[model samples]
Target: MNQLELLKKFTIIVADTSEINSICKYKPQDATTNPSLILKAVELKENRKFLNKAVEYAKKNGGSKKNQLTNASDKILVDLGIEILKYIPGYISSEVDARLSFNTEECILKAKKIIQMYEEQGISRKRVLIKLAATWECIKAAEELKKDNIFCNLTLLFSFAQARACAESNVFLISPFVGRIYDWYVSKNLISTFSYNEDPGVTSVCKIYNFYKKHNYKTIIMGASFRNIQQILLLSGCDRLTISPVLLKELELNNTVFNRKLIPPTIFLEPPRPLTEDEFRWEHNQDEMAVQKLSEGIRNFGKDQLLLEQIISKLI
Candidate 1:
């Protein structure tokens, strides 16, 4: 069997894209989208119809300029998600606005609004996973959303602290970014001499996976942001993996033999004591790479979100 088929034996493969064609071609069990992916999709002529529809909806509803912009942006995102859902059989992760990453109340409100929009279109909440940054406030917001049966996928997670917090909060899923972590180390010249197995990004996910398995935490770990096929292969047995079309195509073409590198521990180990809010902040701060990458990810997503809004504003 090819790598994609072999890997599916142990992990659920998720296409991480906003392009309907790619999602349809790969036929992944689930798909994930963010502001960046949604923006990229809107630029394509084929996808512009959805954007135009959203802009028209926002204009007809008529509100203040700011409200109109926000409404259009949200509608566009949900519309893309709705389109992608038509191709996949499982969940599609829809992210909250990165600008609201730190505001617990705002995150909660926006998450509810996205779900409401999906529900309005006749989609059930079970098929949608709300994506949020791993900020404490966002985690808290996710906790509250969980009570109402809204699942969440905690993104921008780098440090173990973030993973632990999400697991403790009973989040539905956590996307520990493998490629972004690898990028940070390579940028700092910290991994000048490392093997694929020793890749820092792979190592980070391995640590989190081991912790989760050892302690029997139920938060699903879906490795994301892979820079190469090796990183994806290294995490073959993760609960789930979100792969870009580029790498997914690579896997589909190559029939190379690869074994499962991760397996659940036969015996459970004691989980570390939960970190307090202050401790969580300090621990996260000490990991300079995590600190930098988390901030950068949020900023980049926010920038793309603003750019998307500008595109919609012109249409209005």
Candidate 2:
């Protein structure tokens, strides 16, 4: 079996793309999208129809310019998610606006709105996972949403503090970004040596996975932002791995036999106590890499979201 086929035996392969064509090509079980990916997709000539439809819907609703743009943006986000859903048999993670990352109330309201949009089109909430940044407020928002049966995927997770808090909040899943963490270490020249197994990104996910499994937490650990196939291979037994098409293609072509690198340890380790809001903040603050990346990720996603609105404005 090719590496992709073998990997599937131990992990659910999720296509991490905004392009419908890429998801269809890879045939992953699930798919994920963010503002950045959606922005890229909206710029594509083939995806212009979707953008036009969103603009039209927003115009018909007849609201203020800001409301129209906001409505149009949400419409397009759900519309693209609905389109992508047709190609995948599993859930599609539609992210909330990154600008709301720090606002729990806004995050919950937006998540409900997205879910309602999908429901209006005959799609059930089970097929949708609201993607939120792993801010404490967002996690609290997710906690409330979970009570209402809305599932969440916490993204932009960079440290164990974030992971622990996410698990404690009973999030549906947490995406501990592998490649982003690796990128930070590399950029800082902090690592004197590197290997797939020793890659900071790989190590981060492993630690999260072990912690989750040790406590038997139901919250899934889906490793995201892979820098290469090796990182993907290193995390073969993670709850799930959302892979970009580039790495997916490489795995499909390489006929290498690889074993699962991560498995729940038979012995449970001592579980850490749940963190308070202040503790969570201080712990996150202490991890310079996590603090920098989390801030950067939100800023970058928020910027793309604005850029996407610019494209929609032209259509309007």
Candidate 1 residues lying further than 4 Å off, grouped into runs, are none
lDDT, candidate 2, 1-316, per-residue tens: 8999999999998999987777878889999999998988888889888898999999999879888899999998999999999999999999999999999999999999999999999999999999999999999999999999999999999989999999988899999999999999998998878877689889889888988999888899999999899999999999999999889989999997989999887877666788999999999999999999999999999999999888888878
Query: Model 1, 209: alpha-carbon shift in Å?
Result: 0.5
Show model 2 residue runs off by greater than 4 Å. 269-271
RMSD of each: 0.9, 1.1
Q: What overall lDDT, based on C-alpha atoms, would model 2 receive against the true structure?
A: 0.93
Candidate 2 residue 162 Cα shift, in angstroms, is: 0.3
Superposed Cα deviation of residue 134, candidate 2 (Å):
0.4
Q: Write the per-residue lDDT of candidate 1 for residues 1-316, one digit (tens) a residue.
A: 7898899898999999987778888889999999898889899999889888988889988999889899998898888888888889999999999999989999999999999999999999999999999999999999999999999999999998898888888899999999999889889999888799799889999999999999999999999999999999999999999999999999999898988989999999777787789988998888898899999999999999999989998989
Q: How close is candidate 2 to the true structure, as a TM-score?
A: 0.98
Per-candidate Cα lDDT values, in order, are: 0.92, 0.93
